[model samples]
Target: MLLRDRVALITGGTSGIGLSTAELFLREGARVAIVGRSEDKGKRALERLEVLGEVTFHRGDVSKEEDSERIVKEVVSRYGRIDILVNAAGVFTGAPLIEMSVEDWDRTIAVNLRGTFLMTKFSLPHMGEAIVNVSSTAGVSPYPNGTAYCSAKAAVIAFSKALALELAGRGIRVNVVAPGLTDTPMLRGIAGSEERMREFASLVPLGRIATPEEVAEAILFLASPKARYVTGQVLVVDGGMTAGRVTTAGSRAAVR
Candidate 1:
């Protein structure tokens, strides 16, 4: 009952990490409002989460100011106020900079970066406790064909740090959770096949990709009272992928 009677709003809650976090929050005694762009997905999420606790789904694109404002209003209208806000809505467009079109870049930033800004702006008045913005290890570590996504996620970390300082006096703690490769529908779409996913996992030190629940656990900690003194920080849940290059020779040597 870490969040007993608290109210939480989670964007991109239709699937993946956001949906997992919503379930965790509800089980922890929080009234949850899940937001997503797909009405059908939102309905499905509602059906799945309603049995756990007081859960509702709000369908709207976070990239739009009107939608962000309206969604926040609806959540507040029902829950009275927001104790936690989790900005987890994002998009990944993998293409080299020269090959990437202006439209694709704009859409990526709109959903991943602008969406976070709009949601936080509108939800601030109702939020008094915590804000956990989902970032990625890609934000700190660079890779090919991730120009827009990496930039947006990196900005999220910077944004959260600055906002944390600004909101400290108001008792609002802002933090970021940067997860590495995760096992989600989005990752499945990206990986395309099981063999490719296994290949990706082989590159990680832990030999496996993360699960949504694992990342959700981190989010729950940051959002809960357990992290009252934790703010302006980035928690990396990457299975040690970012720790250092794990070479076979190095692994053998270390074992000796």
Candidate 2:
């Protein structure tokens, strides 16, 4: 059990990568608390997790400072201390730069970027351990009409790196896991059509999309003692998408 007796708090844990990570942590001998915005979803996740180990669910918007602070307090009050913090709560919105409104940009940044900051801020005092910030390949590569989402994710990468340096002296490690095109409910929602989803999956070098569990596995490695010396790093689990190249006529372009 790599995480034996550890306590983890995961934001946006009702579904997707967050839920999978919570489940994996519990199986590895960790107690977990998951936060979601919907009570029904939170309760369902809590019920499912309870079958594995000690699990608590808090329903709240991670973008709110009070909710973030309250969740940290609630977890510490119940679990004594927090060994891991996973800021997996995020939103994805796509629109052409010229069409994207201020509200859209603000909302995207608020939940994906600000939420991560607030959660880390509140969890730091209780976290003498590890923190994993979930980023996206969009942070490293440009996607069409993903201005707000891309910028927010890129900010997470930068924020986690800075945080890692700031907390190194305290024995606290911070790292970012940038997942590629994962087949989460969130991604499915953005698909809107089956054809669109298939097209997106076809672009991956694996000829398929990643499961939430795959991404969670990378996150677990970063959070566990196995990565004790790993900090200020961005681990990209993109199924080789960013490594693919393009050939046109007698010319070729290589991608890194």
Model 2, stretches more than 4 Å misplaced? 246-256
For candidate 2, list the clashing residue pairs, or say none. none
- In candidate 1, which residue ranges exceed 4 Å CA deviation? none
Q: Give the alpha carbon lDDT tens digit for every residue of 1-256 in model 1.
A: 8999999999999999999999999899999999999989999999999999999889999999999999999999999999999999999889999999999999988998899999999999888799999999989897999999899999999999999999999999999999999999889999999999999999888889999999999999999999999999999999999998888899999889
Candidate whose lDDT is highest: 1
Tens-digit lDDT track of model 2 for 1-256: 9889999999989999999999999999999999989999998898888999999998888889998889888888999888999999999999999999999999999999999999899988888689999999999887899989999999999999999999999999999999998988899999978899899987887779899999999999999999999999999998888875534531333232
Provide the TM-score for each candidate, comma-separated: 0.98, 0.95
Query: Residue 148 in candidate 1 has what lDDT?
Result: 92
- Evaluate model 2: give its lDDT: 0.91
Q: Candidate 2: lDDT of 186?
A: 95
